[model samples]
Target chain A: MDEIKEIMLDILEEMTGEPMVKEDLDLNLLEEGLLDSLDYVTLQLEIEDRFGVLLPPSEYTKEELDTPRRIIDVIADKMAV
Target chain B: MSVRFYDGFEFFVLAAILSAPAIWLGVTERRIRGYGIFASIVVILFVLKDSPKSILLLAAYLAYELLLVRLLLYLRSRGKAGKGIGRLVIALALLPLILSKLAEQLNIGGFAILGLSYMTFKSVQVIIEIGDGIISDVDTADYVYFNLFFPTILCGPIDRSRRFSADADSVMPKSEYLQLLGDAMTRFMTGVLYKFVFANLLALAGTDRPYIYGVYMFFDFAGYSLMAIGLGNIWGIKTPDNFNKPWLSVDMRDFWNRWHITLSTWLRDFVFSRLLRSCMRAKLLGGDRVYQACMCLMANMLVMGVWHGLSANYIAYGLYHGVLLALTELYQKKSGFYKRHKNETAYKAVSWFITMNLVMLGFEIFAGHII
Candidate 1:
């Protein structure tokens, strides 16, 4: 589980090329407060590759990501599965 | 000059002549894409001086795959299966592809090098799987089949390595070949119907509005994807679906997932997840969950934004959904408004919104840029 988180962080850093230092879970994805959608899907794909968990299209409902903490738990759950 | 120029067209004639032999080998010997490359060779031959594009693309992919094999071998040699080196290995492998495709969209000249964009995605995806310990080992024939399969040549529903190799290694009876021939014939006819009848009848080429153009594009592309998938299916091979009801997705992310199901899944597994994980870990060290989710969503979208291209709109197009996902994440966390409302009706509505917006907007952007 820890390894998966470690892997996830490594993947996130490589993809974003930016530090996540001091950011909040519900903070806007874009520096400008409006995160773009295409980037989101790209991120989802990257997560799948890094973790080897296949995402069904239905998994990505708006309610899914509700918070950063929940997101990690979700990812952890998927990785565990 | 004219005679020399005609030399290129002459190759097509030759390719046609050679295709028969390839068919015989594939059907009789059951060689699959092993013999399919003879067809690829024909395409490459036509692209002669165009060797720069093919050579550059081929060398990069070859080097990437070879390095991947070596790293995994080394890791196994060191008995390091769960060591997490696989993540870095995949990152290293896919970086070139993401860069090259992005460069092409920027019109950086060489990035649009023929089949480079699609093929690179396939190989890179394969390398990641191999590194992750998901894929154990595959024979040479299977590897060849995965890379060189012809039906998937021009555009693709990028076949997974294991799935592709499995199909290649297996054999079907002669009756199956006849069925495939019938299916191929029917599909080819559909392609003809779309190209000659639907595309031209609708005069789809005469449009700028994405919604209108989207319909035509669907027929045009679905036609080809169908033909390819049909050809594969009949031959006792498999292909992942390239499209579902894409316009039906309720949000940008959903739309992307549905639109090019194969590419979307490939990108999600390899690229998007990494971005999210890094963001969550780096900044949110026990920070608010909603806050971190947003940060991850944003970071992910930015990479996706760039992955699509260096263009203003293409980048915006990527960011557009990235923003929505982040907002949606934030929204869901902050309010339980939609929580109790969850039912089939609500689900369908949301799905429709996402799909419709993507179809309406996506077609517009591609039409604006590509057309």
Candidate 2:
């Protein structure tokens, strides 16, 4: 979980050009402008490459995978399944 | 007769006279709603003067959007909003703009409305955001203001509702107002220089026709955007910029980011992102993500192109850039050489030269030089 979290944060920072703190994990990524659709796509690619878990982009929404917390949990569930 | 620098001069004088009270209110008390309202009226009148029939077209379009949005909201309040409903609402919102473009192509001649494309973009955004539950509170007055904000009425930086309203409703301190005043003056003056002097000189440049025309257009459009941003600042609306130093871009994607910054960003957010997501979910490209992305890029750019006009050249220009962007992405991904040499000065210069020529060729196509 921590490794996934680290990878996601690194991608977020790269995409947004801003650092992400722990508190940012719970915030609405889209609303806060921390992530956009393009960034979301890039993040998904990064996640798939790292975890070997392919999360279909259309199967989720910005609202669904909006935060680092939510994203990590979703990935964990997908992996479990 | 199109509006010119001389008319712009008169417009400034007239606008100052009409908006004096609003300007005073901002300076003395920081109030802006009165200014916003007055500014909206001025633009409406200005546009009406340009083409009186546009008023009717605008009214009908606005009526359609407002009714559709309210209806969607009511349905959502009743817990009836679903993906199908959302798609339907977006389609309806797009109908007028689509029809206007189609009518122009067919020479039907009556469907044209000033700023219809920008209005459609804003309306679609409102519906999508509302459907997403991102925006729950919709004020009629604010929506109207966003629709007809004077500076961006014709060509736009396409300010978002939430961002626009925040600036629209805020009270800037006297110090900040003074700073804003200085900034506005600088932008206005620079815009005037770009449009009248530099662009006009380039237009005169039988020195080399195609090269001059391409670069001239950059100045002309950038000048207009700067003027709009300047006026917007004075009116207390923080209109976002549309251009950066686009000539310096090293790739198609980089060029897009710098040139027409707002439109490209809008298409990325609202069009490409959504299209890509849907394709991925449907497994449309048979699990090859790169191929999927390439197809999505073509689709997205083609839509953007058609938005300019339903013409062969425009579509080709869009497809050209789409292919270039996709190929650039593929190269960046596959070529380890790019990763190593990308940071070097000589490599960057060579890349920039290729990107600019490609962009110039696209502009030539857009200018209807071919077909």
Candidate 3:
């Protein structure tokens, strides 16, 4: 779980080109403009590459994956399944 | 003497009278699904009775879509569902809407039916989801009710089959139903003000200017959407909202999220996302993400434009917004200045002003003023 969190944060920081802190986990990535639709597509592709989990865009809404923490949790859940 | 949904005060009064029993059932905490379905049938028939051609077309369209859905379900159940067949089925589902749009473009009559565009959205969504295996079963009555729910039969907040069925199948507790009713009443009244008062005033005052016309469009469409949502609530269907604080949007992308929300989201999920997924998987454009994004955005918006009509003006409007959105994407992704000052209040205000003008320009193109 800790490894997954670290990896997720790294991916987000790489995408946004800014260092992310633990406190930023709860921030709304979309609402804050840290991510756009294109970035979101990239993130999903990266997740599948790294975590081997598929998050169908139709099944999972943007709201469901809005925050870094939420993305991590969803990835974890999918991995568990 | 064809009666249109929500056309006048007389329509609302008649609808209210016809819905009395369903409303009573809802208030008493009884299952209103049966009565709701019954009311929907009566309302649809009454609204289309004078237009025999429309009635026949609607009935035929419904049967055709239902058969396609059932066939798809059967294929899925038998584990014979494949990509080739799925695509064909979806095209078949969209045939009527495509022909209707084409016929309208050629100035041919009798091919179009009331609410055909909105109904196609619902039917196509169901068919796609079923192909995705997310939706395995579809109840016939629930399907008909979702398509012909009289409140949204003309325009729509485009309720999904799964969400609609969930609400339609459940009996809300009295307290919950009351709260929904309260909210519904508020939305309905607000819609009345927006449509009957503000929209009419704007129309009378003049929509000669692009910005004024854009605002008029917002109030008029949003007003209709609100009333439909409110009425849906009374019937226990939590129809999604069509507009947010759209005028406050700071960019073209943000505007889409805040305006005509259902249609935009529908396109995003069904069209844009799928296009991107396929392209990315194939590593199209040699994995040039920005170019791929721009291409998808253009195609998505073109579909939107063509959906409105095959006219040059509508196509130009769609293309205009598509270019604006693509340019916005390119700038945000590639510009160093934007990266540095994007978070500043001054920058955001300037962005908002620019985006507003661009949106108004697009609306002008849509209204055939600039094209």
Maximum-DockQ candidate: 3
**Against the true two-chain complex, what DockQ does each candidate achieve?**
0.05, 0.19, 0.55
Q: Pick the candidate with the highest lDDT.
A: 3
lDDT of 3 by residue, B335-362 (tens): 9999899889999999999989888888
Which has the better lDDT: candidate 1, or candidate 2?
2
Comparing candidate 1 with candidate 3, which one achieves the higher DockQ?
Answer: 3
Which numbered prediction scores highest in TM-score against the true structure?
A: 3
Estimate, for each residue in B204-273, the C-alpha lDDT of model 1 and write its tens digit.
4565655657777776777667666765564457687787876566555556666767766665556555
**Over 4 Å off, model 3:** A1-10, A17-25, A50-53, A73-81
lDDT string for model 2 (B176-268, tens) is: 877887898899788888888898888787524667777998888898888889877877778888999998899887898889887887787
RMSD of each: 10.4, 6.0, 2.1
Better of 2 and 3 by lDDT: 3
Better by TM-score, candidate 2 or 1:
2
Q: Which 10 successive residues of model 2 chain B have the least lDDT summed?
A: B1-10
